[model samples]
Target chain A: MATVSVPRAHWSGRRSTLASIRLAVLTFLADPQWLIPSMIAPIVFGFVSFELFLGTPDLVVYVILGAGMMSMWGQTLYGSGWATGQDRNIGTLEPTLSAPTPYVFVVLGRILWNVVSGLIGIVLVFVVVVVATGTVPSIDNPVAFVVLFVFTMLTLAAVGTVFAAAYVYTRYAGFVQNVGEFAFYIGTGCMFPIVILPFWTNPIALLFPPSWALDALRYASIPGYVGFSWGLGWDIVGGVATTAIYLLIAGIVFKRVERHVLEVGNLQEY
Target chain B: MSSVPAIEARGITRVFQSRKGFFYQDVTRTEALRGVDLTIETGEIFGLLGPNGAGKTTLTKILTTLLLPTSGTARVLGLDVTKDTERLRARIGLVLGGERGLYNRISARENLRYFADLYGVPLAEREKRVNEVLEWVGLTWAADRRTEEYSRGMKQKLHIARGILHRPEVLFLDEPTIGLDPKSARETRKLIRSLLGEGVTIFLTTHYMFEAEELCHRIGVLSRGRLAAVDTVAGLRDLVGGDRTIEAEDYGFEDSELAAVRHLPGVSKVVSEEYGPVTRLTIRVRTGDLTIDTVRQNLIGHGGLQVRERRTSLEDVYLDLVEEEAR
Candidate 1:
């Protein structure tokens, strides 16, 4: 038997917790009710109404990619925050703090589960969309897509942490989820084009990485999509960079808020 | 000084000042740990003995690096608790009261393995270590059982196993054995003793004085955010002075005559109960002065006193301590 390494402060428990949580999530996704609607609705909405929304079958590719990314964002946020509220009620957070692993490792372990769950949601969206629309999302820049995907997921996860921290403090999770949903709608271009949002909203949305990602993914997945539009290239680059900065800022802020709430020590108080 | 000890706290204090609900005008202040200083050696089992609302949990939280002390300093393994908390955390294992380990839906073995992973136990050794720790706490028979289905004693045993699973140098057990039956409690105590022999330092807190007496090499009495006393069990007993209780029946004695017996020397407090024109007086006495013949002689003159029972107990000492604090 190999020796077990003692956790240092720098060590994060992401890899291990992620593996276990992923298995649990996959097991949950195997259930029909949860697996079906979240994945199928967006695809069905895309193919049946593709011409209605985008005016052509070629644009079906962008619709599928947009729906897929939105599903990832939504499902990840949902799975990630549920445990935060439950763990606080059970009084497990304080003990987890007593361990050697950095707090981020513990938190990220929770978030990673959401991401994996989000992956399931994404896969379901992909399968349904591919079957319904009969058009696969083509990736022109797979590397950039992968990089932006991770960055977008991480940034959204950070946002989830902020709300989870708030949830632990106030137990008003409804308000937090509402704000997250609103942010997702505006930042991820779920219902509207990012270019069409007011000039001021663009900068605010750009602060989140997903805005640039949806744009980058849209441009990368469908050829001629970018050529159809101009003067928005800077939005993609600036948005990505700004989103990265916002993610860093959000992570720091989340940690501060979480520590403050823990010091107050009223996790389940209404 | 005894190789610098494993745990030390000097004037540790934790204060919480929070705003009022809704109105937010007044800030309520709670002093959870107040100027508490303590030291425990590397291999000794130290107990923090206190009752509910006595700040035992708050002090434990501070020492474990879960909450920062508002004032003073704590060092775990010579590393400052607040500044080097992560380092301190790795070296220590803490089992809090209630079921903090073993996810309710997961099997016991899976729960243990997950913790092993969190502590960075390598994948190859995780299974073996999980089994070993499970067996140590006598939970191997039910390793496949989901925690939600386990009995209270079983959950407690699994918690103990998880705390030791990482093979930490020091262990902090807060109210361990809280919900266990007599048989399970005995086994838990035995396991704790064995761990001490293996050189794992333990810091424990409990409301049960007998549990502390049986397991702790040294103990501290915490009451009302203060360390009332810290010493060996014998030392604490000495502080209260060895005291005893005597219960006797007085045959053919009325209430007025019972007053005479209560006034006897060394009998500090007396309680009388009527029994068919006979009276029974339970007396608290100083240890050296308590003797059956002496009691018999005091009551024999009336020819109505019948000595019934005499016992020296720790509860008497505990009562004295609380009484002194109340005064």
Candidate 2:
């Protein structure tokens, strides 16, 4: 085997993490059109829903939770779901993909930072909701709520990763992202109870991890609300299990799509 | 330096399937590279020259591990491009032409730093390396300015700076100076020469024959997805076998006159193109069969023509090779 002496890289794990954080911040700062809408839309929706429900205690909790979840969903959609496409548009996808570090890690790092940024928005909206509705959200089980939140974010990140991979092969990523967002908003029982919808919709909504995550959050937050067929602990368990499964599926899908893109030489194509 | 070649590609081929319209039914397969074999020794600047669609970019993509070959094997810095892609990427760098690759929103320094991290440059050395490369590319003064504000040449320089952030042993430059002013192109060429002095092996694909002749230690002329010839500049110039190229500037020359010139004794090839007010004609003839006096006299006799003997260039060699392959 012919070999050549090249300078070895001084490998450092921390550098990639730092770089991803910087990229996330830069990307966020660069696109104010997306960021402002992502932040303001959820808060506005929460307020409108609160008023529509006549400021009821139960609906206040529901709308605020929905608002927080939507904030996260928007971030994940643009930050992770459309990430590869954005890189392709910016012409950085090829160079980033060609780097020594695995492309998946770079993507995951971006997702992590986006999630962090989304958390800030979530907290702000929560504060605004509390101030406007004059109701502090009550968490019946703190541990379960925390577990459900973590699992829900992970699940969304996983779904976003799968979407990012799918975006590479198709030109209709923007359309899909828009449709998928509204689909999740309506299907996941964000503003209203999934039970109130058609009985046939229940099964389809159940397939999405966010539905169960929202169910868990609703049960844990609303006072005297024991509406779920499953108990709070069971709902939390279901969300976690579904999220883990989605993550596994996402990992497999991402790897396969990555291989396909390289084989087809479409990494640079818009 | 080690005895091992910096790059080794054997029987490499790439076939792409183009989908007709939106439907996948009427697919057409186009072979971009057909069984290419190449070896570049360590610290050597190898230039690959070809017209468009000659598989120059395809071959570079394969060696850089950006695109996998349909068949055959390639290794860079001792690592198989397909199997050890991650490792090979660490040891090699790629500079694709065009201004689209870098993040225009970020500063040149920031872009270099980001790539350094992606290349796994150590946290301690990332800053120093970014500064070193910025200065190396002569962009240190504009390091903090957003890249979108930078000129085309500056952006190209930044691309080179990013490629070298990891200090790779083998660097692939695909048309490093495609669209640039003469002075900027010359500066880029000087930068590439300095990199060669650092013992970095460069695999450059370019359309500019003059650039290739000046920088490349060896040149490979590719045509129709195959290596037509691989030799030094002088060796390629010898392909014509002592042929002298005579260039003539004339106006109001008809098609019949061009045909008459083509029938001239010992003339192997005649290329004519419009240049502003004058129509420029390039005639290649055997050195012994045709003298400058005879060619000048013939063109003068044809009426309304001015003839001069221009120096033969690698472009003449390239055009002849490509035209031969096309035939």
Candidate 3:
């Protein structure tokens, strides 16, 4: 249109997860308000638990873990799904889906960014708990605690991939998630240990990968704690197995979701 | 390059079903596309013209690999659009220009760069290509500005920039100049013409008749989800009677006089319309043998007769073809 000085494109670009992550970072930076709303629940959970666990330094660790897990549940677990929902809102879903790169990689990039933001939420909860109690609860193995903590988030991510596919499957997924988030929290024993819930509900809780992953994290962080088969070995095995299955489910679900959306021709509806 | 048609479609139809009401019991099915068959050779500009509800966008989406057809098949760059979408997507570009389809919060450069990644552009070439497309669309001055701040014309340019960023062999543009200013719209047409030098086949759908006549190598008229006609400008004119129009006006025309004009040697169709106290008769002439003087002589006794002759236009041919299909 103007004086032609620009060159034509060739082959476009190779799909790179790094580039997707960079795009996520840039989008978040541009719209700082996105992180604000997702932060509210974790902070409230932290302070509420801190007040209940008052005067017991030993019990205080659960508050921090609960708060952090709350952040991880919303951000790390379902980040990619909500990001897909956001794509629908912005009307970028059709273009991105029409692109050469697989949509899974785009969701993966969103999940990775969500993991970082989830960690930020964890930090905020930690600060909230420490300031509320004025005492820092101690952990015996900080390295294992941290590793298991991140591992739990990764496990949640595996399950999150399926939910991301759900977002692709329908635009109403966010509403469904909102209606079911509390049920999910209770099922996964996000705040309280699943052991305290009805014994018959263990199977339902075990369906969630984060259930096993979070229990393992608590065992590593809290002292004299016993949850879900009472040891870390089975918890890790269960977490890994469930995470792999969820990851597998994510693959199958994505293929079907893509097909469904294409057939329905509703990618542009939102 | 391969000799296959850049785009080929056969019996492609799309029907959308939606459920409404409180219990979602009502089912409504809309057949957006009927059996449509089309082919466009490499490096050709193919314009699809239709009114509002004419399935042009539906046909375009099927060819672009965005939506699946309810029946039949489509191929772009020799790959099946339904089965080989990923592969076809790499070689084709699409511009669905509107207020949407952009990350509004980010800068235009950021949006292009993100799409470059999605399109799988090489790392070394991404920045250069983004800059190039920005300059090509004449958005170089506003490249770093956020898209939310852009005017509709600027955003339209950004859509074009993204569509051409990947150097697609076939680019499908859906109303690329809808909201652009006169100067910008002219520049966009110029840009579209220049892409032909690089062997890009363009499939454009627009409501503007002048645009189709100006840029299309061949054009298709779609009405009520069915294609009425597809031909070159001259060929299409000939399809609807002829390329010439003759009009005769008077206080009124007797049936015998109208019959006399219709029976004239090159006149194909004679239709009459009343304008207050005047009756205007339109004649579609099929050959040069018919002239105004001959028509007036045929209408012998008519008083205050006015006669005019002019060449037919794409709009005239398009309306005739579409109205035929609508019937």
What TM-score does each of the candidates earn? 0.83, 0.91, 0.94
* Candidate maximizing DockQ: 2
Q: Best-fitting candidate, measured by lDDT?
A: 3
RMSD of each: 4.8, 3.4, 3.1
lDDT tens digits, residues A12-123, model 1?
Answer: 4565556446434543543465554355655554553355457654565655556656666665565556566556655655555566665555556666666666666566
Give one digit per residue, the lDDT tens place, for model 3 in B1-327. Answer: 557878899998889899999999999999988999999888789999999989988898888888999999999978999998888898888999888999998899999988888887777888988999999889999999999999988898898899988888889999888877888788889889888877788999999999999999999999999889999999998898898999899899899888888888888777789999999998989887778899989888866899999898898888888878977
Per lDDT, what order, best first? 3, 2, 1
Tens-digit lDDT string for candidate 2 (A174-217)? 67787778877778776666777788988888777778877877
DockQ of predicted candidate 1:
0.34
Winner of 1 and 3 under TM-score = 3
Candidate 2 stretches with Cα past 4 Å from truth are A1-7, A10-15, B247-290, B294-307
TM-score of 1: 0.83
Q: What is the TM-score of chain B alone in each candidate?
A: 0.84, 0.86, 0.96
Best-to-worst order by DockQ is: 2, 3, 1
lDDT: worst 10-residue window of model 2 chain B: B235-244
Each prediction's total of clashing residue pairs, residues at least 3 apart in sequence or on different chains, is 1, 0, 7
